[model samples]
Target: MSLRDTFRRDQVFAPLRPGTRPVRPGQLDTGGKHILYMEDITVSFDGFKALNDLTLYIKPGELRCIIGPNGAGKSTLMDVITGKTRPDTGSCFFGQTMDLTRMTETEIATAGIGRKFQKPTVFPEHTALENLELAMAGPKGTWQALLQPVTGQQYDWMAQTLETVGLLAQKDQLAGALSHGQKQWLEIAMVLMQKPRLLLVDEPIAGMTRQEVERTAELLQSLAGEHSVMVVEHDMEFIRSIANTVTVLHQGSVLAEGKMQDVQNDPKVIEVYLGETG
Candidate 1:
């Protein structure tokens, strides 16, 4: 029988293990509105507070942006969420049940949260398609994937992801040969292959051209409602371009939470973040 004749979207795309399924966000029950829940979380370094009593909640499939000045704890917040750093105190949960503080970084990733940092990391010698295939291999071991034949479904899925990230034309090109913006998109496509439910992106547009930034905004906005996305950025225009809701952080705590317009108009934001009144 042909593979398509027997393919199942709701079933595991590969036989990696029992209960493994193609990453389809919202397919699994989150059991609550928030995909991430944090309360009174704090972190300190040598008598300095990185995150101070920060309480935050994100609903399933919401695209939220976080902005703050230096030491406002933007990156630190992501570190805590991704389990890279432990908080000094407070509770953090993934989907209302998984205690994030209790899980290792690998475990947190397995639980369906993926993080992308400012720098794009890809195999320089590898083709764009090759980089994505490595991501699909997951814990199965790259050598094992190399030994096993690629399934038709996996090819289709990789192709779809490449198209989604607008890298189809460069599919066979060396990842290193691509432009900076293309590298960033390629990195994001790799993240998608893992089928993460919550995506944490940091400073995604720092070095992109105007066109690249707009395309990225479109891509990130499109991701909302399919996967919950949280972005940490300093570019107010980019934040205004895509974020439906923005959270302003100051001194490791939330200073304001509202639409981009409202936050942009706030006097505190003018004095501290934008550097001028609008």
Candidate 2:
């Protein structure tokens, strides 16, 4: 069957996993409104400032797109939010209660922050279903996962997640057998398996075909109402499709923030992000 046919047929009956629970649609900002906040976040690498007093705030269930030129500290911002890199001085909050700055990466993830890296990281040897199973959230004790198989609710969650990411039919296929775009979606599905409150996605359409990119845009858009997504991406077209609010960065600070059209029309934003010629 053609890829299109496969997608249509496979999309149906995508929720057949046994012993899995159906993840309830919950508020992305479970901690009472404020999902993420960064104030005066600054980070430097040997005197070269990567993030200079950067501040960002994301509202609950908002799909925010961040665009910037090279060396604008986009990646560093994500790192700070995820607790992978602590800033020299700043405050990061996961909600009204949890202070992200004091937490470790693992702690932050457990606190409802899920990050999808630029590269897909699914285990090549594992089937897509197994890869997602390994990512199920909760106690990491081997006994909890192995001796006690995932409950039906968990399986339902996984199945729904697979369908959401457009990979339900490929669940039995080896991760190694998927195409580049499919692998990217698989990686995203793995993250969804944990049912995070906030999701941070990076360059989701980096190397996808035109059709794949469009479909991916639709998927992300569908997820916005249920998850607060902070996407750092370079593809302006893809950003336009998914962004409800656009932020432009230059020299580690916000240069422009508004609708895509407004930001694009800003002369300074044009000079920094879009060339004057374009």
Summed backbone clashes in each candidate are 0, 13
Clashing pairs in 1: none
**Candidate 1 Cα outliers beyond 4 Å, as residue runs:** 1-29, 276-278
Best by lDDT: 1
- Tens digits of per-residue lDDT for model 1, 10-119: 22244321123233542444654467777788999999999999988788999999998888999999999989999999878776457789889998888789998899
Report the lDDT tens digits of candidate 2 across residue range 38-65: 7678899999888887767777788999
TM-score of 2: 0.85
Q: Rate the local accuracy (lDDT) of all candidates.
A: 0.84, 0.79
TM-score of each: 0.88, 0.85
Give the range of the ten consecutive residues with the poorest summed lDDT in model 2.
16-25
